[model samples]
Target chain A: MSTVREMLVELTGTPEFADGISDDADLSASGIDSGDLVRLVLLIEQRTGAEVTAEDMDQLTTIADYERFVATRGGAAAQPNGS
Target chain B: MWLTQLAERNRQCFPDRTALVDEHRSVTWAEFDDRTGRLARGLAGLGIRRGDRVAVLSLDRVEVMETYFALARLGALFVPLNHSLTPAEVTGIAQRTGAVAVIGEAALLDRHPDLPVRLRIAMESEEFAALGADGIALPELPDLPDDTPVAILHTSATTGQAKGVTVDHASFRAIALGWLAVARPADDMVLVNCCPLYHGSMVVSLTYMAAGATVVLMPGFKPQTALAAIEKHRATHIWLVPQMLRFLLQAKAMESTDLSTLREVLYGASPMPVDIYTEAAARLGCGFRQVYGMTEVGGPFVTLGPEEHPAPDAVPDLIPAGRVVPGMSARALDDKGEEAAPGTIGEIVVRGPGVMRGYWDDDEATAEITVDGWIRTGDLGYIDRGGLIHLVDRSKDLIIRAGQNVYPTEIERALRTHPAVHDAAVIGTPDPDYGEVPLAYVVADEGTGTAELLRHVAEQLAPYKRPRRIEFIDQVPRNPAGKIVKKLLRG
Candidate 1:
């Protein structure tokens, strides 16, 4: 299965997210808007079956936060180097 | 009076009263005045002069409001670019407006490094914070006429390309007075505004503050944060789009939250689902007011007061957009450019002091939309015997099937009445037999079949108005202002 980082790159459709994007990079700053953020959360819920509530969505600001959020809920483990 | 004078008035009358509250901090009326004054001087130092257009791109923040007032003080036109726009789009708007300066957060600024503007100020940088330093010398304030252009607000572009609607100082002043006359916000009224500041909806916040009411701003609308802010601030009034209200009703925290202080909830930009309105009115125990207006005709010039709201058990009907507020006159115009008879469906046109001056630098487009000092609202509606204006739908959104007119809103409303249907959007799809047919995109709970929804819609609507297809989707695409982007669905 593709890692969360790869999914974000595909979802945002921004080339900048394909390479050298730190896990801590602000998703909003990387061209992800509020509508895009909502879609990302929905995608995560569909794939991981993790219940990301409205409150939880507010705290997931960076790419790493989403990965950890899914992993903590018993989803797939993060790949080394996020390849 | 211009926005600068309004701020100064608030400072003198309610100096110590809270004027603005964001997530991080709150500011008093006096402090807000002082900050804008210094920021105005700082901007002048950057060579921004009267009539200059300055594009601002940033998230909701205290600094954004500061920039608006500061620019208004200098008689410069504030051009707010929607932050969600791509870099190319931002550059395009800046070029179109001939903006000489761009002020925004660092990340947004960095995205468009080659913006045509001559000056760029990052709001997060020390350079920006120092713009409001007390030590900065204040420039002599300009005595701007009320007709001077203040801001160019871009339309939401739900239908097509966004156009910059030029609004003057007189427009805002008229809107403020009109809104105050209708809303009659009390002195102690505290408003929690849930819409983004970039959109024209910011005028609603300014209108409340004009009455010495305190306004709480959010970075963006999140159901949980909005509930918390209302509870923590004891907000007496809240402004949001109907979609936001829906999310608030669905949020897990809503039931546990203390909402006794809420007296009125203002909603607009689209019709409220009768089911949602009934549920909210019962649970929150607050009066609901519907505001109606277009970007071209200032922000909001008509209001459906709380008393006019339908009873919880009342059957859903075509709710009146409202009677035109003071200082504005609205009438339905027939296709021949003549006034339509009462109860006749025609294009709604409004004339008032609050109407926009024109579309920025697009004289042809401006001329096309205006007639005899009246701005065409592009909405089809009619005035009733009681002098209430009822909106039918956007002229472009009306679907014609077999030479019969079919309003998508009517069908969408019918589909929404289904127990399992969460939301629906109807659009015209080209058909060979019928030039166009109504097609629906619906977001519904699991196990809700298209056949079941079709049957429900058929029972409520005429045969011609029923959507030929009901496609299930996870969500209906909408613009930031909560209007369905039907263009996306049609594509």
Candidate 2:
């Protein structure tokens, strides 16, 4: 399955741009603004087959945080695509 | 002191005037000054002090601008991180600057757990809100020299590392003053800034605020949301790159939204397509001006005024970068550094108070670009007999996508990281919507497929920086010194 970071790299369009990004780094610093973040959350929901809400975004500051949140919303379809 | 005084002077002169507005909130000049003062003290209590490098990561918000002014008040350097960069790129900058703290929204901070900093203050968390909620006494604001560094604006280099452009209060103030003198924005003009707040927006938004106008900030550009904001606020001015302008013109809201309130549209970063320009002009019936500047040279230092926009019948192949704005001078220098004759193409160079102090910790780069006092812009253009600056090409391998600068070397470096790739070269191909997009040429190992290479690049780079197409070749031409002949690839 593709990692959340992998998904971000695809969505954002910079090949080496996200290479150094870690789970706790500020995504905003990586140029992911609110609108991008909103879209990212929706994409995560689609791929994981889980509900990734705005409140979840407020709570999940890192991709690691999103990964764990998606884990909690467990199901067979909750796996990220290409995993 | 120059930047800090902007808020203080505005607050004293028009305390109740709305200074800034975003989707969530608005702040009057008085409230802005008081809050920033308190926030500065709060940051001080957290050990932020003079000369501190504070990095801010957030979307477009009043707090972001507040942090900018607050950091200036404390005589600390503000490093506004671009939200679109990768974590490594962000960390590289934060580390390069030795940022004392990274203040941003919690989600952003969460993404980069590895950013080395003394503190990670969540701008929206209860802890941070409490810091501002307590009516803490304002700290002593510093009276900085005009040349004191206020910000470190980052821009990409062909070397794959971003360079930080050190800007002083004087340079930033010069930009605001120069913009005011040139643009002559209405005192009550309400500007809808549709770009990210990290870079050029600072020039556009603050320039308006310096003129005692209110600025409405959009966190990110969405054609519909931008139109709604303009219609809702009765915004008189709007700032966008040509790509966003095209998207806005295509937005469904364009059919019904009342856009008569818009008086001026400022575009820059890349040249606007002739068709897009014509349609936008006809639809908005507003004056359009093109801005030409770079982060390395403070911010915007020149402008193509509304009257100078190309006629519908005229070919927009080489739109002028426009005349130098107030407080700046321009020259087109030949190979030997002599000024190029009018109508002769040369490197576009600028010298002005708005020029940056230098690249942070990059003396070699600083020296290479700054000859005597002029900032070598690296754009190939000529000064026409009528004194208009027309751009023909870029001497530097810089590709402007929409309005964003994308360096091919950075992408080429990413392609080389794949095991199957022997060598890669990237070049810009023109596009109607984005102006230009990267097209990559690859020399790969046996059995390496284009799909595999594409996926490899897609995983490493941001979406915009990724190669739109990959062309496989038997060999890459190079010189004796081993530099790839990019011209042959383009051919």
Candidate 3:
């Protein structure tokens, strides 16, 4: 299972933009623009095969927050489609 | 002071129309006034008086609606706290602003347990039910002066430290009035608002209540629910950020939906990829007006109007945010204080009735931007020969390409056209010969590569203009406010 941050990295191409973000960096403080956040959230859902909604967005302030959100909601059927 | 006063002005002409709505809740002008008057009297009865700052920590509900005008009726400053803020962060702002009261959502006492204060006038659904469930009270009131401090909206805290923008009634009124001139609110002009009430865009939408407009309130934006609200309400005016714009673009029915009632969409909060702007028009019949203004000036001072770009030029060059509004004074100036000749990029400085009085208690920092009363916009832009302003970037975000300037906005706009590229950021990475080269940190859809992106960019740019290096990432770094923090990228 991929970490939520790893899921974010893989889906969003996070390495290009990971310079200053810490695991502790507040989503607002880390400088991830809304555009990036939208893409990252979509990617997590796709990778985990979990349904995410805006109401579910409350806990998405950190990678840990996303991990806990998706990891909990995701199960065996939650895996991304295999080629 | 503004919302309350405007509501009164509107009640005289259109009081019976629906003004505010949520799930299972709706308030008409007459109902709104009765409750607002009662609430203002209620707060006044509790010794909440003029100039007292009240922090509202609640979801977007009718109670929050009453809070805005009720505070305005008493000449108090309204501070709408972002519910998304951590308890500690909320407490920090509350302490810093010296708020006299924080009226929270009556049910959410458990959510924000550590706001550093105990005084809260909680309002909840059941309480509101009891409030007007039988009969609402009407209280006598008079118009408050326009200069009264109506709100202290905090900055988005995207790039640097967050600052409080002390917006006076007059400044707030100027913006709403400006919007009124173009974006009219017919009783049938249903609006779907998903942004936080704290942000000016939501406030702008809520102000349509003054005009008897029906508003579909989505406490926060959920892509599915946002789509549902539009279909149900036949919303005409939808407020959006670019990220939300993308979500709308991706919606299944976006192109096929009966968006006939949709007239115009107002989008801001962050600069968007121009391609995304195109997708919005294609997906929804809504012609968008891209607002370009900062929190200090309250908004939409310069906008890319619905008209297609003048064809003498192409794309963004043709699509520079149109001329300044009637009362506003705008100029592009170089460091030497001389007016930049048309087409010469310089700092955008604005002076007008719409500009805020100053940052709250930040005279020194305020002084740096306000030189002889003209607010230095900090954004680098230029006015063309046709008097339209084209933004380059924020002063700090300017990327020097060899000697030429490469605004990340320009590069981002270019990179968005490639079918495989999702997003891109251009930064000045240190180099030997050029001192600094424009390095592109790019995010591709899935399998796209740096070589393909470089070739894509190379086709559109000169040797000096093309990105010298590429960093592949899963995503670009952005703050909660939807701004790319170059400082973090450099780090």
Q: Each prediction's DockQ?
A: 0.08, 0.08, 0.10
Q: Report the lDDT tens digits of candidate 3 across residue range B381-401.
A: 899887788887767555543
**What TM-score, over all chains together, does every model reach?**
0.78, 0.85, 0.71
Top DockQ model:
3
Tens digit per residue, CA lDDT, model 2, B183-291: 8777678889987877754677777788888899876766667788888889999988888887677554676688989888998888778788888888888888888
Model 1 segments beyond 4 Å from truth? Answer: A1-25, A29-33, A36-58, A70-83, B156-161, B397-491
Candidates in order have lDDT scores of: 0.79, 0.80, 0.67
Candidate 3 chain B: minimum summed lDDT over ten consecutive residues — where? B309-318
Could you tell me the TM-score of candidate 3? 0.71
Query: Which interface RMSD values do the candidates have, in the order shown?
Result: 11.0, 7.8, 8.1
DockQ winner, 2 or 3? 3
Q: Which sections of candidate 2 miss by over 4 Å? A: A1-83, B132-138, B311-316, B458-460
lDDT against true structure, model 2: 0.80
lDDT of 1 by residue, B306-346 (tens): 89888787837666888888999999999898999999999
